[model samples]
Every structure is written in structure tokens, then in C-alpha cells.
Target chain A: MTAGATDKAGISWLPGRQAGLALLLAPALVYYFVVLFLPQLEIATASLMAADGRFPVDTNFRRFVTDPFFLSILWRTVRLSVISTLLAVIVAYPIAIYLSQPWRRWRAVVAFAVITPIMISAVARSYGWVIILGPAGLLNQAITGLHLGTDPQHLLYTETGLVIALTHLHLPFMVLPITAALQQIDPSILRASRILGAGSMRTFWRVTLPLTLPGITAGATIVFCLNGSSFVTPALIGGARIPMMSFLIYQQGLDVRDWNFASAVAIVLLLSTSTIVIAHLIWSGRRQRRAAGAA
Target chain B: MSLPLTSQVFLEVEDLALSYGKSAFGLAGASFSARKGEVIALLGPSGCGKTTLLNLIAGFLVPDHGSIRVAGRSLRGVPPHRRDMAMVFQNYALFPHLSVEKNVAFGLEAHQVPRQEREPRIADALAMVGLSDSRTRYPRQLSGGQQQRVALARAMVVRPSILLLDEPLSNLDTLLRKSMREEIRQILDRTGITAVLVTHDQEEALVVADRILLMSNGKIEQIGTPEEIYERPRTEFGARFMAVENIMAGSVCSGDTAGTTVNTAIGQFKCTPCDVVTGANIKIAVRPERMHIVAATSGSQSYENRVTGRVVRSTYHGTYRRLLIAVHGMELIVHAPVSSDDSEYSGDVQLTWRPADTHVLLQ
Candidate 1:
């Protein structure tokens, strides 16, 4: 008999072998069904049901599509999330590069500082931003003390405040992945570039930037998804002056007691986020294929 | 003493010194020069400042003292990118994200060469390295030797004033190392580029370098051609490094116009003319292959230096037999050519060499 056939027969001959495989997968399967699948299925069903709960209809979805107020909230949510992700990337790139250097002690200190905000509660962190962006807060005090402007500008309860808070919240996610990518790069490659008559700026543009694309894409993806679905920071810092999709969903479900409409909004948010993520995946996959074909 | 300045002097490093941190004993007062179209090998063991010296010349590490000159121009305050020198790293250092063609064209692009000119130069470099077919391949797609060739092409494409290599063949297998060493020598000769190579392999230095600068403990021990280094080592370290296995310590007994006599543990031996006073301490060295072995009963007893020893161990090395002999409680290694008739001799043998073969080290 062939070795493969004999091994298969022996495995099948043992009692409870299949049961053992089932047992190994039981916990994860059960957890996924109870915690994730059930809630999503209920939301899908509720999103289609009418307000009187008589029969399934598309009333909530129709309202969502036809109402100009809901449409504007969705658009604003997308725009703000994109801006926050870009801001995080701009702030994190230099920090990631610095952390990738060989300075051990300083890197540890800076890394701790970057991740410290995440350890605090999101509400508390939002309040901290409120204190700083308030009229009588530290920023206005510094501006007036430095004589840079005549009056203290009102920054709280605005889209700018929300963007700043969201960017700070997601900064660590952006820096960590890029730092890992930078650290994986071989130091001799940089030295070789310099020896081959490339200045530091050229080396960064040609070699460093291209090599770190995977990390940047990963970090941007994470920040975009999280900020798009976030509820707390926008509610506190934006203060109804700028309405986002998450705040409207919260208002519909809990404050107004419209569970069906809330479910519909949640479904829309999930669909749009999934669409963007899948598109990004396809684009990056094509790039990887092109790279391989060239090789 | 200073040599006359000539346009042929491509690179000159004078009184270069550097120390790691505050340590008092790093590379000190090293000076060397290379002429145009000459390949100089910095031959030494590990931790012998060979790589440090290369880094200094490449402007990666600034010297604490002295100056490096290229074609009689001082290279002070010049960054590595501005310095007209290229280096082939030991690990090849090919960019994983770039294709072979793009990697070779990187230097030209940095220098702002026109696109039309760059394309032809890139093609020429790839053709020279015999990788024209693999131009679109990335570094990860090539074998170790192929990646090394790509690195060589990239470095040479710049047409820099000097080329530096740091143990370029150290990562290859033994058989590949031999072939690559010869290939590198051929490439350098064809290009006529002034190059400095750092390596610890004596055989590689002997084969590839036009001149070898032997170093020890951050100091140069000797500088000479391969033949001179093999035949006439000036110090004990140089002799031992060259694999001259027979070294004997003794004191000078007498000196004359003809030759000198030295007394040692084995016997008094006559040596070639050397500058040493009578009663001064000395050491003598000779290569194993230069010693002749004969049966104890043979009638060849007229040699100047002779010793009687018993064979302690013998090893068969396919082409030759290496025999260890016990003479006066000291073991001496001797290499004898493998032959049908000489394989039978075992116990007692007489070794002899002419006085001219003995190298006297007075230090």
C-alpha cells in the first residue's frame, strides 16, 4: 500500500478522530455564531421591517436614501474620516522613521508616549482635547501670551476639534506598523545608496518611501475604518454643530427610540466600509502581482 | 621621507588615526597609497582594522587625524555621496524592491543623466555583467552569485574614481569563491579601475591582489607582492600568517661574510646573511614544502641544515601527504608529494634544507 493511503486508513480507523477535530474547532465556531453572526442577522432583519412590525418592508432604507439630512451626515462622516486618516499619516511617518533608528532608550520613551493616549478612556481623552481647544485653555493662553493673535479663536464644538481628536486617537495605529516595516529594512541598503551617489533626499524618495508602502496602506486602512465608525469623539467635540453618521445612528436608536431606522443606518455604514476595504485589497493585490511579474 | 607627487597616484591616505569611543588603542597612524589602475588588497585577520580603513576612505567614518586625498585633492568635509568612490558590499546589498535594470540606473538618475543616455549605460552595465536577460528580475529572484554580479554592475556603472570592496567573496562556498575570485580579478583588470579590497583569505589575496598589504592588530606588518610575501617575510607574524609552519627560536652563535650560524633546541643551523650581532636572539622560519625528507639510511648528508626525527603522524591529503615529525620533543610538520615509492617510509627520517631557504627574524 502507498504511505499516504495507509496513513489515511489508520487515521480513519481510530475512534473519535473526527470528533476530536470537531472538538478542537467547537469554541471558535460557537463564539462566532453567538457573538457576531446572531446580532448581524437580527440587525439585517430589523433593518427591513416596518415601524409597526406588521411585515418586512424597505421603509427605513427608503427614508435613509431620500432624506437629504441623512445623506449629508453620511457624506460628512466619510470626508472627516478621510481627513483624519491623512492627518495621522502625516504626523506618524516622521515618528515611525525616528523609532526605526538605532537609538534604543529614546525610541522606547517616544513609543510609550505615542501609545499612552490609547490607554486612557476615549471619553476622558475627548474631554482632554476639549480643555485644550477651549477659549480659556492652554492653546489660547499660549497664543495670547506669544502675541501671535489679538483674540482667542473658538475651536471647541467644531469639525476641526473632532478631526484633531480622532487623529490623535488613531496615531499609534499608523506609527506602529510603519515602524515595524522600517525596522525590517536592511541598513546596508541605505549605505549602498549613499555609496552609489544618491543623496539622502533621493534615497528616501526612491528607496525608503516605496519600501514602506505596505505599512502605510495597512495603517491607513485601520485608521479610516475606526474613525468612520467612531461615535464618542464626534459627539463630544463636534457638539451637534457638525453631524456624523455615527451620531445620527446613536440618536435614532437610543434617544429617539427608533431601533429599525438605527439598524438600517448601521447596515449602510457596514456596507460602505466593507466596500472600501475590499477595493483597497483588490488594488494592493494587483500591485503585488505586477511586482511579481516584473521579477 | 616623501615620494614625489605624480599624477599616477590615484589615492593616498596619510597618518590616518581613529579610536573607538575613548579607548586608547584603535587604528593609529596608518598610511598607504595606490596608483592608477592598481588593485591593493588589505589582507588581515578579523579585528585588524582592514574594514575600518576602508570605511575611512569611503567617508563613512571620518579619521581623527590625517587626510585622504584623491588625485592629489584632499577629501575633507566631503560626504560619501559627494565623494567619487563606489563600494561593493559584502552582502551584495541589492535593493529588493527594484529590478536589476533600475538598480543599476539609480546612480545615473541621481546624477541627472538624460534618459536616453541612462538607457544605453544601463544596458551596457547589464551586458558587461552578463545579466542582460535578467534585467527585469528583482534581487530576491536571483541566486547569490547572480545578485553579486548585479551589485558589481551597479557599482561599476557609476564610473567612480575609486572602487572599494569589503570581503566581496566571503559569502560564497569554497568552489564558488575560487571561481569568483578569478572572475573579479579579470573584471578589475579589464576595467583598469584603481581598487582596494579587504579580505582575510590569504589565498584570495595572493590570487586577486597586485599587491598585498598584510596587517595585524590595527597595524600594517608588511606590504609586498605575493611572491615577496611568500618567500621573504620580515616578521614572525608575517611568516606564521603565510603558513610557513616551521619556526625555530635560537640565538646567534657567529656571523661572517659567508653566512651566520644559530644554536637552537634541535641543533646548530646555518642561516643566510642577516643583520644580527653575535649573541643576539633570533628566530628562523621555513615553508613546509621546502623541506626535503629522505630515509635515515640515505647518503645525502651534505646539506647545510639537517635534523633527524621520527614520524609521529601522517595524513593523506589526496595530492600530498602531511607528516608530523617529533624532533627533540618538538613537533615539526612536513609536506611530501604523494608517490608510490615514498609511501612505505614510516619510522625515522632525515629532513634537510639549504641555508638559503632559512629566513632569519631578528625581532
Candidate 2:
């Protein structure tokens, strides 16, 4: 009797399953093609064209690779993004640990403060940093007033300014993931470590840090990719003095009207960022496999 | 000042007290001691400060007004790691990222034991727990009993002066718990390391511990050997906790060479001699298994104490049958061994017990 009922149910379900799945998947497929694939294909095709809009195989690519000016900008972008990610990780780790404590009366307040910048527009946040780090800004005024330095420092249009702004923008991304990982750790594990004769530092190094590496990897990948491709913060804070890959792409596309060069630079930026993220994923995946196999 | 040459007690806790904010559910002046190589089980119900006392001794929590001493040395201001004690957590908090070998080697690494010495010790510890073949497996891959054994091996590898266990067998199934109870007893005997175990299961305590420290409401109700704590309870809570089902309030009528007679709602009962004045009110307890059921037609049988009642309920419990009898407005439970003639007895039934079986709780 059960077999007959199951066969009847299977017969009724089989006919509609294909049509039902296609109907459910239609919107996502359409959105992906229209929003992502079509524009990317256009950019790829345009990147291969010469300056005269004729089909040339390697003109723009060769120019981008050989030009020392563009090479320095690309290197600077990658270096600054790496630095900003490291700074964000260093600053966010302790805050994540504090926020993951069992006591929760003040965690909500600190978490709101950490996430408040993401709610505001990036342009507005960059302008706020401008007021803070500019000459005769609040910091300079304090420095001059305290006689710590004879002259006001020029921090407004430098790579240091860009890194500081980018780090501030991506700090929350680093903190939230690490905090989630920290919270997943059982409190008994920490207590067990202590009872087994590990001091606080040794316990964290031996147990807590290894357990939370997945979260750190996720947060670092996101922050690195986001900061690498960011254009708004650099344009507003670093001005024309610091030349990042994103700013170069923006200049070629809009200021000089060099569409081919702009597309080439954009492709380069996408490839480099994806390379870092993919490499990290591969390394962490191998580590996880090794750990599982050892166990 | 001269120090004592030899100290008899291995671990001593004096006048420990703690309070949880405004709540009264915290340890209040609990004191106990353990000799070297003794296994003491802190047996109590939930919210009775057994775990809290364990935490206090482990340095996870500080006592508000007390001091702990190990081997005549005061343990004030000593952190958990520096105190040289090990613990087996209830959930067996093995490091999920590490293999079993690394988990057992963690304490040795903490103490800066050299790698050359650590490998052999780890191997021996794993072999002692009978998990030498599974040392490379993660804790998640092992069974519950295997994980518990790993936890035990990890604690023992450090060779600490004392070991603490927090509800170690409560996480296992009934049959596994019984076997693990015997395993823990054997391990403690072999190691001869002073240990303190926390458990709420009376049967587990009875099987595993050398001495039982029964607690109630953050206070030590009684402390004695397992046989003593089971056969003779000093307080009503201790009696009830030991599964003594029948308790009757009565006043002492008289004392003679035979025994002391107490008059109760279920008629007079002759109990073992206790230091109680005549006409003083007292309470007495009898275990359910001690009460024997006989046929109502057995007339004038010579029994120290006898009562007749109707069998209200009878339950077949495989090896034994439990019968609830209504006796003089009070219900009494009787556990009888199941035999071939184990048929339901209706109507009147007589329950008999020796005078020595009645335990008098003075408090």
C-alpha cells in the first residue's frame, strides 16, 4: 500500500518539477545576464581595441603593461590595500574579542558605533576625514596648540591619508566576522585550557586563535578586495597627488575620455583583486583539508 | 616559625562563601577536606552549589570568605594554571581543531615539557585510556564514551596534584554511564591521584566515589563514605536524596533493651536505638527495597514492625515489581523481586521490616 501511494505521488510530482524549477530560476538568470554578464562582455571587447577604436589585439594591454606611470599606480593600489587590510585586522581583533564577551550590557553600544560609518555615505565619511586631517583641521590645531610640532603636517593628499580612510571604512567588515567566529567558541573550551595549565596568552595562541582563523580569512579577503577596488575615498581624500588604479581608471574614462584605456585598467584591477581573493581561498581550503585529514 | 613535617589532608577548603549579586543561590560556608588518593564526589541536585564549589577549587571563581590549601600550602592568589590542578569538563571540551594526540599533549606543552619526553608520555596516557589506536582521530569523530576517556587521559597526563571532574558521566547513556562509572573508579585507583567529582546522580556517586559529600542549598548536609551516607543519613534531605521513600513523623514513646518505640499515624514503630528523649518528636526513614510484602493470610507472623494495607498499584519492572500500598492514609512504596509467582495482589497486604532498617534522622 505504501509503495503504491509513493508511486502515485511520484507520478504527480514528476511532470511539474522541471517547469517549476525553471519558473523559480527565471528572475535570477535574467538579472545576472542583464546586470553583470552583458556589461562585462562589453568591457572585455572594448579593452582589446586601439586608441582609434579599431580592432587591435594587444595595443591597450601592451601599453598598460609597459607604462611605468600606470605600473606604479597599480603597485601603489595593491600595496595600500594590503596595508589597510592588515591595519583593519590588527585594530578589529581586540574589539571583536571584547564584543564577544558574555556580558552584553555595553556590547550593543560599541557594535552600533562600529557599524555607524557603513550607514553613512562614503563621500560624506571621506569629507568628514578631510575636516579632521586637513591643515588647520582639529588635529593640526591641537598639535600646534600643544607645540608638539612647529608646522602643520600635510596629511590630506598622501597615500597615508588614503590608507587611513580605507582602513576606517573596512574595519567593521573585519570585526563582524571575527566576532561571529569568537562567539561560536564554547566558553568551556577556554576554561578547559586554563585548567589544563595554559595562561591567558598561551590559551589564546594555542586554542582561540587557531579556531577563529576561518573568520579572519573571510574578513581579510572581503576587506582586501573592497579596499583595492575603491575609488570614492581616494578621489575625495588623496586628491590628485596620490594616483591609485581606481583613480586612474576614473580619469581615463571620464576626464580624458579614453574608453579603451579605462576598460583595460578596470580589467586589470578586477583580475588582481580576484587573484588575491582566490589565492587566499585555495590556501585556506588546503589547510582545512589537511587538518581534517590529520584528525 | 616552624612548619609541620607531614600534613595528613591533601586538600582542604575552609568556610567558603559566595553570593550571586542579590540572589541567595550561592555557596554559603561550605567546608570539606580530602586525604591523598581519595576520590570524593560532591553529590547534590541542581542549584545546590556543587558546580560552584568545583569552580571555586579550580580557580574559575573566587570565594568571598574562604581559603583553600593543598598539601599544607595556602592557595591564595594562585591562578588555575599555576595551581597545578587538572579538570575533566562535563562536555569533554576537547580542542576540535587538534588531533587526540595534540589534545592530550596540551598540558605538557604548557608546562614546557620537551618534545622528546612529551611523545612517550602522550602515548602512555592514550594507552592508559585504551585509545592508543584512535589518537589521530578528532574528538568529533569519536563516540561519547571514547571522548570521555580521552578527556580523562588528557587530565591524567599532566600528573597534577589533584584532578577535578564536572558531571563526567552525566552525558552518557544509562548502560554506558554504568560502565564508565566503573572505568573511572578503576582509573582513579590505578593513578592514586586525589580527585573531586561533581555529580547529581546518586547511583553514580554510590558506585564511583570513595566518599560522598551530600549537599543542599549551598551547604554540606553530610559527608561520609558511600555506605555510611546511604545506610545512615543525618538529615531529612540526605535521606530523601538517598531514595528513602518512606518517612514517618512520630514522637518517642519509650526506650528499652529491645529498641526505641515511636508512636505515629500508622501505629507504633520499633526503630533502632537513637539518642532521643521520651516524648520528643522525631522523623524516621525506610528505604522502599527494605520493605517486604507478605500475604494477608499469614497471621501472627513474628516481625519487628508490620502494617496491613491495600495494594493501590503494582508495576512490573522486569527484574523487580514495584507496588504502591495505601497504609493508614499514607502511600508507601515497596519493591519486591519478580518471581514466577509474581501475580498482582489485590485487597489487603501486609508489609514487614526489621527494627534495624528504620533510620532515625535527628535533623
Candidate 3:
């Protein structure tokens, strides 16, 4: 009798709770529908139209795939996005580890310094990077100062410069998630690893790194997706010589007045990012299943 | 200190101290020694430096002063990994990514144990913890008791000089806590490894430890066998922590070879004296369980201390009845065993106890 009463009581409150949750989520749902889904749906429909405006056509996609100019732009976009994302991971780990230490006297200051840069406009940060990556910039001066007898390298308008700028721009995205993960690690687990006779480096390898894999994956996805669709940093840093998929979409849509082709390029970029993210999710999920299944 | 004479002292901490800011000692010159196969429990309330002392021993926290030695070698500059110690954490600290067998094998791999010998050892450790059948399962898949067992297996497989347990049973429910504490005690007995268990649960300490180091405010209040610590606590903190509810402030009425009768608002009560003289202002305490209801028991002994009081309230505990008696403007607690006639009695009742049960406090 009490069980039936409790079941009814449990069932009764759920709809009200769900309604309240839906009410709370109403704004985000509406915003995503209007600001995100509608534009993407419009782009998808436009991307399928031929130049003569016929429905269900693939001429724009065919042009993008066959044209080497657009193809190189696609490859460059993926290559730069992957490299910058990898670099962000490598850079974010040490910074995240430093920020995760609650005992450090200047930890709050360091965390502020790492995170507050995101508040600055992306264009302003790109300009700051332009100063550093210029021929007479801080990076070139430091490189030549090492006395390798090399001239000032032209990094201001190159793919390498674009990668450096993107890495800097997306650092906070990577570091914030990784820092949260690092801090979430139980301190006693690290101590347990140490007391079990693993040194600091070994503990990091065997314990800390594996535990923060989810955070790294999340950060990498965000950085890679952002870099894939990036417009400003590439335009300012790489210039016209190193055009990305986003740059092609911008140039074709507005300057060249090819809406169908531009929408196709946009859809391609979206699909590529989604494909990579989904494939990675599947791989990690399988790995977790294998881990759970292994003796 | 209670170990057999044949066993050598395996772990020694001397004057180990760490101070926060400038003045407050995190651990104020704390020192204790454990024999080769004895279990020592650091029993205390929270924020009393029990965990700080455990961390110092594990080499997780460095001491500001003094030294720790294992097998007669000073561990002044040694890192935690090189200290030859293992800690079973309160949260179990199992590697979430690793399965049971691999988690057990982690320490061996870190120590570079031979590839051929690892499997058998892991299997044996699992069997010891009764987790051999669940070797493929991750820690999150296991129950809390199972996780604790895995933690024990992982710690014991390393065969360190000293095994440390930091409130390993606090996370378990009461029923599981009881069984696990007994299991832990059994495992330690079988392994005969020197262990330092840090716990706030005095009952857990009494059940699992050979000797209890009662601590308060960064210092060892008293250290003795569980029997000695419980029956004859040296400090008020020790008595209170051990559940002595009737701690009262009194002065020595008179003293001789027999016992000391203290004067308090409750009344003069004769008790076994310790380090006191007449007319000295001091505090005294007694365990409530030692005070028996005179009428409840058929024929009460001629208890040296007797008080007639009105039973203000009576609470029925499963094992015994707790009665609050108002005696001479002061409340005293008496525990009455539920005899065949378990009827509630709430009136004037005589409570009695012998002098030896009343523990006269030294400080």
C-alpha cells in the first residue's frame, strides 16, 4: 500500500518538475531555433540549389570538390585547425595543471591572466598577435636573438602565423575546460598514486592525463570547430595568400555574389567539423567500453 | 607500545611539527612509534591534526620540524614515492580508467616488478579481497564495500613498510561500516603489516587498532591500548571523545590512600583519584554507562557512590535505557539495562556506582 502511494507521489511531481525545467529552457530553445537552426536550414536548402536555381541540385558541391583552388582552401582549413587544436592541447595542459593547484599563492592571478584575455575582442587580440608575428615582431626578434644567424622570418602572413594566432585566440576555451577537469581530480587520488610508488611524472602519465582526457577532448572539439569556421584571425594574419574555407565562403558570397556556392562551402565546413567530432566521440566511447570490458 | 617484545619498532616519528602562518601548529611536535606488525589509530575530532599527521607520515605534506624514520633510516628529504608507504584513502581513490586487476597491478608496474610475476600477484591480491570474480569491472561499477576492498588490495599488494588508512570506512553506511571495519581488522591481522589508521570514529579505533593515540588541537592527548584509553582517559578531551557524558568541574574534598571525593553542584562523589591533592580546583568526569539504576537491577551492589534523584527523562535505546536524573540541581545520566520488566520508569530513582568507575581528571 505504501509502495503504491509512493509510486503515485513520485509520478505526480515529475510532470510539474519537467514543466518547470522546460519553462527554464524555453529561452535557449527559442534562441537556438531562430538564431541557429533556421539559418542552417536555409543554408542547407540553398547549398542544394543549382546556379539556375533548380531544387535538389549538387552543382555547387561539384564545383567546390573539382576546383583545386577551393579544394586547397579546404585542406588548409583542416590542416591549420588540427595543428592549432593540437598546439592548444599541449599548451593548455601545463597551464591547467598550474591553475589547478589551490595552494599556489598567485594561482588566482594566474587564472585571471589566462581567462580574462577572452573578454578582449577577437579582432583586437588578432591585432595583438599581428604585432608579435610581424617581421620586426617579438617572435622574430626572439628567434634571431638565439644567434642561429637566420634573418627575420616572414610569419606575419603565413599559415604558421595563422596557427599561432588561432592557438592564442582559442587558448582560454581549451584552458578553462581543462582547468575545470584538473581541479575536479580528487587530490587524494594523486597522493594515493604517489604513495603507491609512482613519481610525479609517472603519476601524471598514468593517472592525471587519463583522468583529464574528457576535458581535453571537449576543449579540442571547441577549438577545432571554432578554428574551422574562423574568419577574422585568418583574414588578418594569413591574408589572401592563405585562404581558409570560411574565407572562401565570405569571398564567394559577398564579393563574387555566388550564394549557392558559398552556402555549399559553409555546409562542407560544418559537415567536416561535425564528422570529426562524431568520429572522435565514437572512438572514445568504444575505448571506454573496452576499458570496462577488459579483465 | 603494546606490541610483543620480539617485534622491532618499524615506524618512528619524532617531534614532527608544521605550523600554519606563524604561530598555530598544524602538528605540534607530534611523535609516535609503531611496531613491525602493530596497528596504531590516530583517533580525534575533525581539525585536530589527525589527517595532517597522516599526510606527514605519507610524505604528502612536509614537516616544518623534526623527522620521520622507517626501519631506522631518516626520511627527511625522501619523496612520497620513495618513502615505501601505501595509503588507502577515504574515497578509495581507485583509478576510474583501470579495471580491478589492472588497478591492483599499478603499483607493481610502477615499481618495475617483473612482467612474468605481475599476473599471479594481481590475481592473489584480488582473491584476498574476494574480488577475483569481478576483475573486469571498473571501480564505479562496484559497491562501496567492494571499492574499499579493492583499495585495501591495491594498498596491500605493494607490501610497503607502513600502510596508512585515512578514515577508510567513513564513506560507508553504518551497517557496512561495522562489517568493513571488522573485515579491515581481519585483513590487517592476516597481513601483519604495520598500519597507521586515521579516524574520528572512536568505536572504529577501539575495534581495529592495537593502540589508540587520542589527539586534540594538534597534540596527542593520550596514547594507550584501546582498553586503557577507553576506561582511563588521561584528558577531558579523551574522555569526551570516548563518549563520557558526565564531565563535571569539582574540587578535591579530601584524599587518602582509598579514593578522592570531589565536590560539585551534582554532589560529592567518591572516585578513583589520579594526580590530585585536597582543596585543588580540578575537573572530574564519569561514563554514563558506569552509573547503574539501583532499583532496575534486582540487588544493586553497595556502590561506593550513590545519589537519589528524580528521573527527569528516560530514553529507550535498543541495548540499554538512558535516563537523565536531576540530582541536587545538576543533571546526571544513568544507563539502565532493559531487564525482563522493560517498563518505562519516570520517578525518583536511586543511581549507584563504585568509586573506581568515577575517573578523576588530571587537567
Best by TM-score: 2
Can you write out model 1's per-residue Cα lDDT over B88-151, one digit (the tens) per residue? 9999998888888999998888777888899888988889878999988878788888988999
For A1-295, candidate 1 gives per-residue lDDT tens digits of: 2578775666553467678778879999999999999999999999998889955898999999999989888888888999999999899999999999986669889999999988999999989999999999888899999999879977888788789999999999999999988998888888889888988998898888887888988999999999998888888888577878888889999999999999999999989887888898888777766665541
Give DockQ: model 1: 0.63
Interface Cα RMSD in Å, per prediction: 1.3, 1.1, 1.3
Best by DockQ: 2
In order, candidate lDDTs are: 0.87, 0.89, 0.88
DockQ versus reference, model 3 = 0.64
Query: Candidate 2 residues B1-363, lDDT tens each?
Result: 111336378899999999898665699999898888888999999989999999999999988999999998999889999989999999999988888999999999998888899999999999998999998888877889999999999999999899999999889999999989998988888888899999999998988888899999999999988998999887899999999989999999998766789998998999988888899999989998889887644453547899989989999888788889999889999988786666536668888998888877886
Scanning candidate 3 chain A in windows of ten residues, the lowest lDDT window is A6-15
Which scores greater on lDDT, model 1 or model 2?
Answer: 2
Give Cα distance to truth, residue B28, candidate 2, Å. 0.7
| Per-model chain A TM | 0.89, 0.90, 0.90
DockQ scores of the candidates: 0.63, 0.69, 0.64
Name the regions of candidate 2 deviating beyond 4 angstroms.
A1-26, A293-295, B1-7, B256-259, B296-302
Give Cα distance to truth, residue B281, candidate 2, Å.
2.3
Compose the digit string of candidate 3's lDDT tens values, residues A70-140.
88988999999999999999999999988888888898888888887689988899999999999999988
List candidate 3 segments past 4 Å from native. A1-63, A67-69, A142-150, A254-263, A287-295, B22-25, B248-270, B273-275, B296-299, B342-348
Query: Model 3 chain B — which ten-residue stretch has the worst lDDT?
Result: B293-302
- Native-to-model Cα distance after best TM-score fit, residue A287 in candidate 2, in Å: 2.2
Residue B141 CA error for candidate 2 (Å)? 1.4
Ranking of models by DockQ: 2, 3, 1
